[model samples]
Target: MTTVHQLSSPWRHDFPALNTKVHDKPLVYLDTAATAQTPLSVIRRMNDFYQHEYANVHRGIHQLSMTATENMEQVRQQVAGYINAPDAQNIVFTKGTTEAINLVAQTFVKNQLKPGDEIIVTEMEHHANLVPWQMMAQAGQLTIKVWPVTPSGELEVSDLKALITDRTKFLAVTHVSNVLGTINPVRDYIQLARQHQIAVLVDGAQAVLHQQTDVQDLDCDFYVFSAHKLYGPTGTGVLYVKPGRYEQMPPWEGGGAMIKKVILPTGTTYNHPPLCFEAGTPNIAGILGLGAAIDYIRNIGIDVIRSHEDNILRYCLEQLQHIGDVEIYGTPKTRAGTIAFNLIPHHAYDVGTFFDHYGVAIRTGHHCAMPLIEKLGQNSVCRASFGMYTDQQDIDCFIAAIHHIKALLD
Candidate 1:
């Protein structure tokens, strides 16, 4: 493994929050999986939009509105290019990944699934992916099936195979487990669903930040992720629907921006799928910031960032293994840059509080995957996730804080 100092992350300085301190101590941010720190480039781009070129897009004929509309549309193209989609028309902007998944549930799933049809989901899904289907199933009298998780926090392929029957109408799963740091075999799973003629939707919130994603290569029916996790602004995300599915689905929401003609008494005619989904004034500045964030990632090279994160995860795991009374979770052959562990003598929340005193930030609790946590026979765990700008010192500090907390507890 290469030393951390030898790793070149010239873009580290682009994030201003890293240099700031909390209580006069340097802040060590280890919560990138939840939300990443935005780069200065994205921030500056959004500021430029508000300061000089602010206007309602696609509504007015004025010069400002035209310019805003052009920028917004160009960002949509950039987003499509980033994910290797066939065209920009396949991308639909939304509030975030949660909303995108809900859109699919309401528009595509509701339209196709019958009363007895089943939707298969894994035990490792966040609530955003799980609850939407569960609610829809309840309302429509559809059945919800789950794929079991192995002891190592991976989905059992055999179990998944057994669950997929002719009754299965759709399969939704996460590309990466947020709490377990497990990298699921999404491409293989999609292929299996294809064999069964089941549509597949992938939750790419965690995977997109750690690696490069190509929707064409994955061959999924739909892919969704939030920009906030990718060093971009909040209130912005994307849903990528295959061209065939895009044409088949109905509109999820109804409002001014989505309609072509609204008759006063009798009927309303809606626009095409993407615009029909976006009901009103969209988050134009947020999308601009996302575009800037994509530019930053491309400039720094995602491949290089992924390599660096892999090395850091390995180093963090090795260091934690050396410490006494620390139990690590999710030992997958392929994993992301998240580490979930527990101290023997202390609750995970207590451990988190101790780390806070040392200015070390980490997440604790069920991590929104209550079913998986119960399956692991643990109430909660402490998590430390990595990002492109994370360094060896941050990992060392986290490990030291854990040891300190353990000593006091013991």
Candidate 2:
């Protein structure tokens, strides 16, 4: 195991938000699971695009429009390469992970699965993954099967056989738990799901930012993640559809860009794969920023980033455990940098409120995973999530802040 300082990111200087002072205290942001702070590389790319190359993509015939469309489409290839997808044409841009999940549920899953068919999701899903399926199931009268989570916060893999049947139409599971930080055995799940002919969509929002994901290697049917969490701009995300599934799927929404031809009397034809789903004009500057962020992460190497996060997580786990009142949750076999815990005699919100006094930002409450948090028999918990910019000093300061908060409250 390496020391936290030894794993310190050389790229922290790329993020300007880390330099901000709140109430004269330097910011120690630890809520990256929600959204990551943007690197200047991403910011500059967006700024440059807006200043010089701004245009509505795939619609205009002029020079500015063509250049903007090329830049945006290049990011599609970049995303495909980032995830090692089978084809760049399979990558669909959405507002974020939520919209991506909705795309699958409405267009892909809805068209295929019928009433009384079953779909499996974990107890650990963020609402983005869970709610859309719940809505779809409610509408289609489909049965939603839950993959039970072990008390230790891992998915109950042994229960998979029992949950999946021939009637099981789809399985949408999170690659990593936002609250428990569990790096779930998703590959094994995918392998198992394949035998039963279940289409799997992996919610990669929390996992993609921390580690590299090769969709082709995993062989998942669909993979969705938000680019913002990868230190890119918000309002932009990716949906990577497996090669064969594109032919099976149809246009999700109707708009100008997704159309091939429109005849008044007879019919209308739709554009092919990627553009079929991207109905309207997209966030061009944000897409450029997303590309820049991917470049930033690639320059540093994901393996290096993972190693650094592992160091930080180990250090954080140790320091937080040393505090007596701390109740750390989820003893996972493998995990991410996001850690959840509760301070006895103090609610999570109160702890988070006090932590901010020390300029340490953390998330509190259910974190949009109400089902999982409620399953744990707690309404709220304090969550400290990490990113590439996080370091040893941040954890040290967080630990000190917790002690001070406990002492002050007591």
Candidate 3:
């Protein structure tokens, strides 16, 4: 346990935002679950693209347009390689994880479900995963079933097994819980869903930062995540469709590059699977930044980052547990980078604000998982999550702020 205090990240300098001073003190950023601090490499990569190689892609013959198109396509391939996707075509770019899930929900899953068919979602889902299915189920007169979370904030496979029936056509579950810090065994769930011939979509928004993702290994019909959460620019995301699934999904949106050809006053043919889904001019600079972010992760290796963050998470959990008033929410056996808790006599907002005043940043609220919060018998909780650049000093600063706030409030 003493070695945790000596552990420090060598890559802390890569993120320029960590050097920022909040209220005359160095920033102690513990809110990576909300959005990670962008590294200089991603910023520089986007700036260079906008300054030198700026142009629209896939619609022009000019040199700049060709260069931008090549770069964007290369990033698509890079994303594919990063996730061990079978082909680049399986990767579809979207505005973010929310849009990606909606795309699958509205088109692919919706197409398959009948009026009485059911879609299963877990209580731990973010609104992105839950709301879309709810909307679709309402519109189509389909039933929505929930897989319950245990008292310890972990999911039980037996609960899911009991929920499955012939009517279960689709399942949406998170690879990791953003609020509870639960690393769900989604691959096993996927296998179970496969046995019942149900399609599964794994939301990887929180998992990608701390775990090495392999789409083929998970074998989900669809996987979605945002680039921003993975240390890239905002407004960019990836949705990977399994082989042969895209051919079944009709385009969710239509315009611009998503068409093969438009015949006015007649029927129009659509482009291939991914291009058909991407619609309109994409986020060119953001996609390039996403490529740079993946490159950055590759250079340092995901295993190394995971080991570093696991230590930080273990230490942070230990420190929080040492404080009697602190009530940690989830005690999942396997978790990665986040912990949610609240001080017994203090509201989460008060504690978070106090932390902010002392140059510490932590997320406080439902974390867009209101149903899970309600299940935990709380309206909201404070969350502290780690990143690849998080180190022992940051954890020390955060712990000290917690003690300071406790002393004052007590």
Report the number of the highest-lDDT candidate: 3
Of 2 and 3, which scores higher on lDDT? 3
lDDT of 2 by residue, 216-330 (tens): 8798999999988899989999999998888777887988899999988769999888888999888888889999999989998999999888888988897887789899889
For each candidate, the alpha-carbon lDDT, in order, equals 0.90, 0.90, 0.93
Whole-structure CA lDDT of model 2: 0.90
Instruction: Provide the lowest-lDDT 10-residue window in model 1.
Output: 1-10
Candidate 2 Cα misplacement greater than 4 A, ranges: 1-4
Give the range where candidate 2 is weakest over 10 consecutive residues by summed lDDT: 1-10
| Residue 277's lDDT in candidate 2 | 90
In model 3, what lDDT does residue 5 have?
44
lDDT of 1: 0.90
For candidate 1, write residues 1-410 as lDDT tens digits.
55767444566788899998866779989989999999999999999999999999879999999999999999889999999999998999999999999999998999989999999998989999999999999999999999988988898778888998889989999999999889998998988888989999999999998998999999999999999999999999999999899766888788878999999886999998678889999999999999999998998788988988998888888888899889888778899999888898689999998888888889999999999888878999888999988888888888888878877889
C-alpha TM-scores of all predictions:
0.98, 0.98, 0.99
The pairs that clash in candidate 3 are none
